[model samples]
Target: MSALSQLDRGVAPIETGMLPRPFVVRSRREELADCVTLELAALDGEPLAFEAGQFTMLYVHGIGEVAISISGDTAKPDSLIQTVRAVGAVSQAICGLAEGARVGVRGPLGNSWPVERAVGKHLMIVAGGLGLAPVRPIIYWALANRDRLKSVDIVYGTRAPDQILFARQLLGLSAADGVRVGITVDLADQDWSGQVGVVTDLIPSMLRDPDETVAMVCGPEIMMRFSGQALVGAGVPAEETFLSMERNMKCGIGWCGHCQLGPHLICRDGPVFAYPAVRDLMSVWEL
Candidate 1:
């Protein structure tokens, strides 16, 4: 392996150029039943370069900071796309904000998915619940560079059929050539005809050369643990599997203690980590 690849084999390098700034909410749209997609423009109307799979700390004037994943690409730096679910006090407050409202933003933080590493390799993305937000950018990146990569597969699971975010967009991508997208719901309705089990159940159906494929996963810890096991069982190497984890992150930077997991800090060392790096901590209750 090359020297840079050798260095990055265990962990991704720390990225630069992301810092806090004030931004304005240019627009907001309801993406799904309870999810809202916010479009943020810089206070001076400039652009911010961000990588796919990275997240930011969104600061509501009086509410507080909440960690959100970047769903847009660096190509369109003038605006940012953040999809949030109204689940907590701060999230509900954010959902209530209107367009033209001003908010504080503190990053394009965290490590991004290894897009370059995934080139020419079969890429498998598994997302569950609101986990789709973190991985959404990679999907767009892959679609834009379809020829450079091999097969692109996405398997997502939601709480219910109505709770599926980016449903139309994903379905359209799945219909296109060289892409496979499967969806599952915990509980199905009469209208639902897709997979009806956990997201792990769909893994076996999408076959690829495990040694030559890279799997990226984001979701609940339990879901990630099970999915990691499934991928290993399907012959994918443990190091080739990456995971985006969610901890109670107070500071998007590493200062706060809320997001720590053992020697690693979810906000700093990861929000995205290789399966082997975090597999041990998955069993620990609080770190």
Candidate 2:
């Protein structure tokens, strides 16, 4: 019998971060050469509720587990969605899973973006590369709550045209009322004619009133740092700007020290933080 089956049936089981819930891969879509977006459904038929900026520890059976951000609409709780980039052993295993494969999930862990704070203000979502996946839920939230928000502006930058994730979806979002989307790339091919520069370069044109804008940025550490600087320089308050920091998180819980940045644990204290909270540490080389 399994270890779980041998446990005393008379006693109540304690919930822990290490215990994984079962989920089945309902569908998977290739977003880029190395990334795939998986739509998961709980085997128990219950919903996996999650906030916009939270991530989950996805376990690939005997392979291992990796923390991945939720990329689906928050309002739709019945289905769990995660975008996985095949960068490591576990993620590679996950990306290779077929439909109907069973996977283990540990959480909707970590804190979330303060999107509600921008209810009455302009919501500016800035992302670079795959960073867009982590912040896509905010876009869904903004679109749904458009009447409550002053404006919704999204600025995205990727290394090249082909590297863009959710390209067609972003195109559709651009046409939404009260929403504006700006896209840029570091390099362009013959078919590309959009802006050719870093995402920070597009900040000026997207910002209508810095004082009234709340910026949420996620990308590589270097990209997020520069984006924060650009937003602050454009007159947005440092506290009004938030960033999602990706680190070497071994455990979704704080038991592991791998995700520590100074006094904060990226997995526990935040993957999402006010720009001012991590600005200094982000500048440190290899810290």
Candidate 3:
């Protein structure tokens, strides 16, 4: 995720510019064999304030920087929480950092989800694998104010049971706040009991009027494309749906061409965009 400068939109601006600040790891929790969530405290002791869906530039001292989303509740401004999967050299370095390790924190960056647009509308959050991390803050926000909508449905798919993020919390949240929770896995073990298929298979069962629903999708690019097709096939308008896209980001700022996707720069223009605006672009090969 990338951020427009605080000087631009007032929504949830971080300190302006690309300069990195220091934050100490308060604690870290292993969510899966390859994933961990870090609770960070600013050297100044302030909570990391940001909007839902925004991300930060986390820099490991001897390593480098990588853009990762803020996965903690937006309601909690006193703590910065980021869940990361160990996928590369930088990520591995950050994940391996011990308690009390210090790292540079650049931002609460990028465009956030269209939470404002979804007000009074029923919500459908579709996520695949760790894509749940990007949408987690939005889930927390909507659930915190559950009465403002008709319903909130979460559809998540992973490779298997053990790879699900926030499995324990999803159970409790499902029973409260009238939120409907659905899970599916592409591959399952003998212990798995839920639906077994693609994440899009759960769409038609959502039942809300397509016009009254606002869908938020984030996952593998191909999975998102299929999810978009299913939701639209089920009646949701393309413009009302949003997708959080991921790309190879070199500079969190748009100066570098690294994250370019046609005319839009994924880092600056969005990690979040209305489906209609990006449907064609996302279909481009290797985008």
User: By TM-score, who's the top model here?
Assistant: 2
- Worst window of 10 by summed lDDT in candidate 1: 10-19
- List the candidate numbers ranked by lDDT, top first: 2, 3, 1
Decoy 1 TM-score against native: 0.91
Candidate 3: the clashing residue pairs are 2-110, 3-109, 3-110, 47-78
The runs of at least 3 residues in candidate 3 whose Cα sits more than 4 Å from the true structure, single-residue gaps closed, are 1-16
Candidate 1 — which residues are off by over 4 angstroms?
1-20, 175-177
**Span of ten consecutive residues with least summed lDDT in model 3:** 7-16
lDDT of each residue in 1-287, candidate 1, tens digit only: 54345445653333322235778888998988678999999896667788988888888877887898988765787889899888998888777779988887877788889877789898999999889988988888888888988889999988889988887887777546678998999999999888898999999888578888899999988999999999988999899899998887876667657888888888878888999998888978764
In the range 71-138, model 3's lDDT, one tens digit per residue, is 99998988899999999999999899878999999877789998877789889999999899999998
lDDT of 2 by residue, 1-287 (tens): 33244344433322546678999999999999999999999999989999999999999989998999999999999989999999989999999999999999988999999999999999999999999999999999998999999999999999999999999999777554678999999999999989999999999999999999999999999999999999999999999999999887787778768999999999989999999899999999999
- Evaluate candidate 1 by giving its C-alpha RMSD to the native, one decimal: 6.5
lDDT for each candidate structure: 0.84, 0.92, 0.87
- In terms of lDDT, model 2 sits at 0.92
Q: Indicate the residue-level lDDT of 109 in model 1.
A: 81
What is the Å distance of residue 280 in model 1 from its true position?
Answer: 1.4
Alpha-carbon RMSD to native, per candidate: 6.5, 3.8, 4.1
TM-score of 2: 0.95
Q: What is the lDDT of residue 144 in candidate 1?
A: 86
